[model samples]
Target chain A: MGTRKIVIEPVTRVEGHGKVTILLDEAGQVSQARLHIVEFRGFERFIQGRPYWEIPVLVQRLCGICPVSHHLAAAKAMDGIVGVDRLTPTAEKMRRLMHYGQMFQSHALHFFHLVSPDLLFGFDADPLERNVIGVARKYPELAVQGVMMRKYGQEIIKATAGKKIHGTGAIPGGINKNLSIAERDGFLKEIDQMLAWCRTSLTIARDYTLEHLDELADFGSFDSNHVSLVRADGAMDLYHGNLRAIDKDGNRIFDQVDYQGYFKYIAEEVKPWSYMKFPFISSLGPETGWYRVGPLARINACDFIDTPEAEVARKDFLSVTDGQPNNITMAYHWARMVELLHAGEKIRELLHDPDLQGGDLVLKGERRGESVGLIEAPRGTLFHHYKVDENDQVTMANLIVSTTNNNTPMNRAVEGVARKYLSGAEITEGLLNRVEVAIRAYDPCLSCATHAMGRMPLVVELHDAAGRTLDRRVRD
Target chain B: MSDSVTITIDGRNIEARPGQTILEAADAAGIYIPRLCSHPDLKPIGSCRVCTVVVDGRPQAACVKPVMDGMVVQNSTPELLQHRRNIVDMMFVEGNHFCMFCEKSGNCELQAMAYRFGITAPQYPFQFPEKEVDASHPDILLDHNRCIMCARCVRASQELDGKNVFQSIGRGFARKIGVNGERALGDTDMAATDKAADICPVGCIVRKRVGFEKPIGQRLYDTRPIGSDIEEVRA
Candidate 1:
């Protein structure tokens, strides 16, 4: 028999489109497998020559799910162009509040809507039964609580920033509006419930992991470098902080460095197969420099969470790693819940602060021509760099998104799972699911990284000798 | 009483004052006729046909067509609504409207109308036309790409500001808003605070030193959909 290939099209339930192809050698043994991203969006090319002020709103179209992250990052970058080191207390708090809402909603979306079915049901359950609708039908209370939690977070975003998606609360120097007493009191009523639900979600995650400990660890776990932003005291910080990265052995690869010298530490390598760029630590080079970002990386890299309840939960989580980095990819769900609870507490803290309602919202200044804005988005560390002329027109722009940072690790996880599960010429549905589950663990936002202007349906084709298409599947 | 006349619009009987255009009558009655170029303060210029309504079995520009007594008008008919959507789609394609990148996005009447119509994507092919940005103005910037050629700024400049700083040049696809006969807006007496500067319905005319101040979501349309003010009053 000639070489055989199996392809799965339109990997479902993740943020964007992806496909997996596994190649079988003549002996019907799995040889090579790849997860290919099919779209390319050159935002960097189109954004050039636009006025610097518009970058904040322009870059937000990158991803509908996480527009707030891009919106805040771009606005922060513009702060440098306008020549401000820090915004006023009121401005800072308002932005932090907005960011907390973003994190809470995004994490809630992933947990309750996207991944909970797999954790609740078996991974090989009926495909139709492993969806949000099924979760609602099976566990009505959990579904309702998740929906309410997401709604509460969204209301905060709407009240504070404006609308939930692509809100324009953050500007170059500061924000336009202040949080009113009424809005504060309104959110205050929900804080207790939000916090409770978040904690319950955390407990659920813990139960899931403990119940499936060995399988979770061996599923997609791998050793790689981890990167995230942290406060000076080594607390988990998403909005404002310095870059910190740790190697697989929990060694400090880089610590407390400003991201302006990012090129000196991080470099991106491009492959022709995908539009997503592979970023790594420059010194170590591509082969071994690949690192993971997002919740797992953030939890591993941080000394402790600043929030009280989350801090207590953190110690329990660290016991799993024995103070070393936890490389199990499934732990991202657990780490995400921990951060969700922290974000709930953070939102409550910021909302009650008197400084948040202050009148000083903006700081006008001179132009600086160049600046870099780096923050930890829900997916991972996001970087937005801009170079403007004296007229404040953008001459150059570079964005390193979270999913791009996790690309190498995601690919590695795909390979690991495929190698572990695939055995013969016949590709079983259960084995295919294992490969997809590996990718879903990272929760990669392929849409954000690709920034595709238009969309096409996901298509997978099987090829034989002379590259003739034998079987094809398409998902719209 | 003699100046008032009654007309049927979308099967609803509404009073119309004599000599008032169909759009003006509909507006006074709290019925929003989708319009782009016909501002209440400005004289009706039927440049944009977004407010086309079927009158007595024929389509007419509501902003310019006078309301006749006992006139049967169809504004929200399925066919008329589709026609209006097409006009809005044409306007979007005629200009380089990157609503994603536009500063006037949330506040833009054009974008809001598109939203009201539930236009996720324009059905027509995008015409990526080459346009110019006249940033020579120290106080204001004019982006030709976003101009729908509605001439609101032209009317605001001539009739309100008393300075003809803006005018329309060329015709057809080549037609564009000009800064005082091809001269830059900076060379003219157009101040940043002038009504003409604020008259643009799109991101064509932007005031310098004041951008994204209101933030996107808190802007005019973000709080509520366009025409909500008029529609809600009657509701």
Candidate 2:
């Protein structure tokens, strides 16, 4: 056999555009596998010379799917610029409510809209039947639950952030509006129903993972480092916290490091093949330092979850791995559901807190010229670093979005799946789908990572050693 | 017949002072004629053309055209309303008015006018012109992106504050507001308390560090239309 190449362009069932290429040797053995991010958007440069105060609202253009994440993250960075080390209780709670709302809606959207079809219909199921419409046709109630749950979360965001699209809620040093009595009451009325649905979704994911454990154990699974933000006491704190990273066996690589100084601990490496930068722990170097982020990493890095029901659910999830980190790529769905439930619990707890109605919203102290804002976004960790001049104009900006943080891990997942599934010269729909399933586990938002826009169709091409096209399949 | 001049606007008779402009006469009658450049306190400039109304078979700017005795004017006819909507839409596309994140969003006259006209979006293609920001001032910001060249700040600086701090320089598409100083608002004698600082109808000249302080529903035009106050006077 001659050396051959298999290409899957613009993988489906994911947020943004990406492609995978697998190289096979003459012996027909897998030689190399890589995931390539093709688009480029210079957002950091685009925001240069803008006023510092506009950053929170301006960064929302980064991704419509997770605009709240960018809005809150940029606001946190601006808080540092305004010289406030802490926010008022009302401001903090309002922001927390907004963030939890974002997390809940985002996770629900990813699971129900993106992942459910693959789970409901097997990975090898007919391409025509493997989609959101198919899921809706077969599981109508689940589809409705997803839509209503997403709407509820969106309503919470609107109440806190003031609007749905480009919210101006989280301003520098504080929030613009505290929760009104009517808004709080409205959300309170629906809290129990939202919580019930969250529980149901959690059960679905957990049951599915447990049922398919044997098949999924080696299905693109790997052992690596995990990174996330945790509270001072090592509890999972999605909104605000210090950095924590643990090895594959759950040994602390670095714990409780301030994210403001994240550059000193983490650095990004550039590769010629992809537009996205590969970030890794500085001490371990690129090869060994690359780690995973998102729900799996967050679940692995934290010692405990704060909310009552989520903590109980976390205990149940941890038992499967004997209190160790769950490295299974497919386990991301179950972990995400755990977070979805936690976000719902957090929203309920925040609605009842009287501090959310407090009047004191903004405060300012000594000002700083440069600062960094880090948040555990729904997808993973997001970083926003900025340098503002004396005129209040931003002279510099650097953003490490969540999807970019998971770049290396996504590639690794693709390679693992390709090695296990790619057996012959012909490319089957099942083989192409397996690659997409692995990458979709991260829920990567490539549009945010690359900051680009355009529609892409899935194109799978098979080529010979001399670069001759053998066979090509396209799915629009 | 009387000492005061009488004019009929939209078929409603109204009394006006001898030297009062059409806009003033309409104001006295509690009839709202949409105007952007003509502020209550500032001298009428008639630059924005939003207040254009049919008078004696011809269109005239209500802010600058003096009302004539027994004159007939059409202020809110369907044709005039569409004309006003088109003018407002042009103002939107001529400049980059990011109402979503603008500090002057709800309070901005431009935005309020758009809402009153039911403009979901501008009909014309956006210019997306590159503009400059003069945030050099410690207490004020001069964002040219939102500047509609209303000259409210220029007139307020000269006539109200008795200071020649702001002036309109350049013409056509290259037009922009320039400070008396060489460059930057910080170099000018403009003070945060100057009338020019607060006279802007848009987000052009706004106080720093106070944006988004007023909650959404409490903003100036949050629950009411732009000319609701004048309309309420009739009620």
Candidate 3:
């Protein structure tokens, strides 16, 4: 009685290509499972020798889904290169608007287009019916809201960044453009409607999580460290802040450390099996240091939400776990909605501010040779570091994307789900779906994480103890 | 006015100076013959045949072809438009032009010309040739990846700056703009204010620490076509 292997390649409903392998022992009990990010794109190498100013626009090629995150993060790093510690008010506000717009749209997209099908219809539902189109056919109103909400956020980005594709909004030291009065007015007209829709989506997620708390509590859930950016006073700050990492009980492992010195506190570990790298706290090393990021992690690590509406929502979310970190993987959806509401509130506040229309757009100071930029992207914290030559050519680049940060946690979630759901030698559709549900909770962008390319179809393969294929199932 | 010569361009009668080339005559008459190498202050070099025009029955480089009295020239015909577009397309593929991230993006004449010609993407396959970036100069950078070998900088260095700092070296595929000094641009007498440093039509030669100074919509040729200034004269 040797072990058998079950493989799910190109996990569906996620941003990029990933594979899940569940190993079963002689008793048909799950022994191990891993989420393998298979694609390898040498983006960091491609960025070498490029002019420092081009990085903000160049790094956007990493992921189309979260180009804004890369754009802003690279811009922040380049700002340090240009020797500017702080941007002008107008520039800061404009970039914040652009970032919140990105957060709003990205979170909305993950919830509606990617995760809603699974939530609306149980995870065991037919594969064909578990998609956005299926949602449109059965839940037309929700589908319409998702599309409109995503579009609204995109429109804000276009107005701020100057276009939907390859936006050049953020630049070194500051943003390239200011929010015009007309642009502000345009968003103002739709703010109320967007806010209403945000509430509705939050209600759906909150209700769903609360209704199935007991079931989801044990479903792919685990206790782990959480990392995110927090304002100096410990409020959740997506755009800019110092680093904060907390353990599962919400105790601060590290607090208020400048991200510029992140390499001192955080380190990345590499394994032969996957293209993605596992990130963990340097002090705790590889095993206990690994942490979660994105919505669930941010929700747990922050002392409070800065916005009014989102503050209330955060309290309710915290009450569910008795003011402790909620480690339930499925709670990611609810956490995401709370963030969505915060982004909306922040957007409305920024739009009404006079600073957005200010004239000064950039500030310059003494330049530096090396710098790091960090931002809490929709999925998680994104890091961009670079070393520039005196001639302004980029000599080195290192990126730790959000998905890559969650590498270990995703594998752990896969293993947890596989152990609980997998049974017998024959592969079942229900088991395959559960594994995906766990991975999708993280909203991992395999493409961005691995810098991969090409088509990704969910493929599940069953192999006997001898490593020979017994049965295979594919969903494209 | 007395030395002006009359020419028929695109079926329209236009007056030109006796020594002016077709491109010069077209410029004086508010008609635009698109060009890359030809500049107002530099001597015309008849390279980068983007300004090719049919003089009478044969095609000629508008930048070098003198305007003869009663000369007939075809400028913006359908065939000529496609020919110019093809030339621009070749320039796009010949170099690794990452227009999206290039500092000279909206302000680059080569990029503006492509926009004017309605080119969403280059028709030819991208060469993606290995290129060198020379950033030895303190205030300027020379990225060979964006060079189209139009000789604007070469002519400007020789005729305008009077420094002879830049010269074309090698031939055909191996051709590149070589600095006067043996090593790098830092050793050369080239200054940031040199006419050659500001004459490149692409991102080949750009000032350091000043990229993306102007926002997108406010950049040159953002709201209008490349030759809108000359075309606006007609209106």
Candidate 4:
């Protein structure tokens, strides 16, 4: 056979619009593979000239799955506009509580709704029976628990922020509302169930990983720097903390640094094929600087998790490795579940804090011209930087979302899967699914990836050397 | 003048008081007529025409049209709804209503109306009119791009705040809500606490000191589509 091509036009089971293309040489050998993000919404450009204060709410439209991250991140950036370096304890606690809610809900959504079907039913299971509803059909109890688990997290967000999707709770210096005793008690009553389900889900996720250890251990595996935010004591911190990056050799590339200095370490690369920009560490250069983010990267970069239950799970997740940064791509699902457990534990801990119900929500401050905000979104590290005029109107804005940070890695994983499983034989639907499974491991929010919009349909296409259509597959 | 009158709207008989507009009667009867520039607290202006309904086989602005005894009105008919959706689509195209990048988005009445009408995209061509933003005021911002010429602010300032600080400038496509005769908001006596500042049906006028104080998916419209409350009230 002459050189051929295979294209997965809309990678299924991911958050938004994306595709993977594999090119073969004259010998029918893998020559190049790339994952292209086909969607674009020019949020950064359009947000210019908008009032700086409106950013937190305006940017949430970027992605429905992880709007809280954008909300919190944008608010933090505006904190500099108000000239407040740190928020009051009460304000900080409320924001942290909201952040934990976001983390739990997003992770629950990914693990239960997005990835569980693939793991539980096997990657090559009947496509129609390989969805959240399918998982519900096979394991109705787990399905119900999953829905409730996500709902529990959403309810916490609604109670704190005012509503679940795009509540205007977090302001520049602080928040608009504090947790009421009644509201706190409402969540407190459900904390036990939340924790129990989280633990159960974590166990299932671990077993799933072990059952598929051989394939997962080597599937889409590659060495790269891992990045995330860590608390002062080196524990995993999702809401607020310093940026940390660990190299493939398991050495700290950067540790506990203010996110304001991110420009010094990170730079973005743009390509013609995709509107999504490729971000990399400045020191390592483009190819080497492409580090991974999100759950897997977060777990690898942190020394230990703060929550006791999650710390045990974290140890088990890291056991398969020889003390090096875990490079196995499929382990992201496991790391995500561990974080979900930690989120539930953290929510329980914060609810008991007296400061959560305190009256001091906003702190007055002067205005500054520019600022940067950074947070570990459920997907990974998210950055929002803005420059305002003296009138506090945003003159310039830039955002580096979590999915963009992992863009290079996602492409690399696609390349690896294609080269391994697709080089020589007739491409089967099952083989194409393996490639998509690798991409799903990242749980990328492509909507947020481009600061965009989309029940996106997934399609795969095959072509001959002459670009003649060979085969195509689509999933509505 | 009779105290009460009966009218049939959407095939349902409802009571209406004399001097009440069709919209007012609809509100009392638990029927929601989609509208802009119309607020219970403000006098009905009938500028947006979103609530246009067929009364006795004639199109009328429900907010201004008086309820009548034995009147046959069409509120939920396919023709009326399609016309309403077109009016909304025109508003979207005429102004730069960038809901994806707007602050008042989820809570915005215009956006909620669009969602309620299932307006995925406006059928009209986007003008992409270049609009200006007035950020001179420390506590408020007036973005001309998102304005729909609703005149809610004009009535709000003149009638409610008694400030009379806002007025409509020009006519036709060039018309816009001006702050104190085209002066900046800070140059006028309009305070952030003024009713005019809060009465904007679109994202045009917004308080500057706070943003995203609420989380996403939990805003007023996020919880339920606009006009849902009226339906609930009817129930």
> For this target, which candidate reaches the highest DockQ against the unseen true structure?
3
Residues A344-402 of candidate 2 have per-residue lDDT tens digits of 99999998899999999999978899999989999998999999998888999989889
Candidate 4 lDDT by residue in tens digits, A1-476 = 66677777778888988777788877767788888777768889888877887788788888788788998999899888899998999888888898999999989988889889888988788888988999999899999998999898898888777778877778889988888899888888999998999989999999988888898887988899998988888999888889898898779988988888899999999887777889998988897989999999999999899899999989988887866678889989898999999999999999999998788878868888989999999999999999999777899888999999998999899899888988875677788888889999999888788754322335666678788878777664
Q: After aligning candidate 2 to the native by TM-score, how far in Å is the CA of A376 from where it should be?
A: 1.1
Indicate the DockQ of the complex predicted as candidate 1. 0.42
Give me candidate 4's TM-score against the actual structure.
0.83
What is every candidate's alpha-carbon RMSD to the true fold? 4.3, 2.0, 1.9, 5.1
Of 2 and 3, the candidate ranking higher by DockQ = 3
Better of 3 and 4 by TM-score: 3
Runs of candidate 4 exceeding 4 Å displacement: A451-458, B1-130, B146-166, B179-203, B211-235
Ranking by DockQ: 3, 2, 1, 4
**Candidate 4 lDDT tens digits, B64-161:** 99888999999999988999999999999999887755768778999999999999988889999888998888788888999998888899898999
Query: What is the TM-score of each predicted model, taking all chains together?
Result: 0.87, 0.96, 0.97, 0.83
For model 1, how does the per-residue alpha-carbon lDDT over A368-475 read when each residue is reduced to its tens digit?
989999989999999999998765568898999988898899888887887778756356556677777888888878877764321223345566645667777655
For this target, which candidate reaches the highest lDDT against the unseen true structure?
3
Model 1 bad stretches (over 4 Å): A451-476, B1-89, B98-101, B109-128, B155-164, B180-190, B193-195, B215-235
Identify the superior model by lDDT, candidate 2 or candidate 4: 2
The candidate with the higher lDDT, 2 or 3, is 3
Worst 10 residues of 1 chain B by lDDT: B209-218
DockQ-based CAPRI category assigned to the predicted complex of candidate 2: medium
- What docking grade applies to model 4? acceptable
For every model in order, what is the number of clashing pairs?
Answer: 0, 0, 0, 17
